[model samples]
Target: MRIKAYGLVEFTKSGYVKTQAVVLTLTVVLLIFALLWQPTGMWAANPVFGFLEWWVLLVLIAEVAETAIMLLKFKEKEAALR
Candidate 1:
């Protein structure tokens, strides 16, 4: 695989691209719902919704960490190639 400066090659190879896309879509949908419907109260009052929100956040955080790791590895590989 060709190593690019941005390190996207490794990120895509690790298969987190699809997961990040889905989580990002879900986050955007949830944000729109919360904004248009003003469902902040419901999010807090409903256990299920609250849990959903937290779950999304947790998944997002995990994805971020995975991406960071992949980027770091890519950087190391690029450095070694130099």
Candidate 2:
């Protein structure tokens, strides 16, 4: 059978998705690095980098929430078509 899926894997395979994925991965890696580099610090020492860190976290969260909403919408659409 020709199987199909939705969400990030099948629904989004465009250039934007690739760029978003790469940026998301890099942000996560940077977050980990920042945390590791400053085990006790609440924020990065540099104010600008700290702002960037927050922006990355917010973007990551928004991406996750957006993906979940898209998956739910796709499932609803599929069900309606059935």
The C-alpha lDDT values of all candidates are 0.60, 0.60
Cα lDDT tens digits for candidate 1, 25-79: 8776775554455237646687656566565566667767766776676568778
- Candidate 2 per-residue lDDT over residues 1-82, each given as its tens digit: 1112433344433443565578678879976765555433655576756566566677779877765665566567667769
TM-score of 2: 0.52
Candidate 2's displacement at residue 7, Å, is 16
Measured on C-alpha atoms, candidate 1 has an lDDT of: 0.60
Model 1 weakest 10-residue run by lDDT: 1-10
Alpha carbon deviation, residue 13, candidate 1 (Å):
7.9
Q: Give the TM-score of candidate 1.
A: 0.49
Query: Residue 60 error for model 1, in Å?
Result: 0.2
Off by over 4 Å in 2: 1-24, 36-46
Per-residue error for 49 in candidate 1, Å, reads 4.6
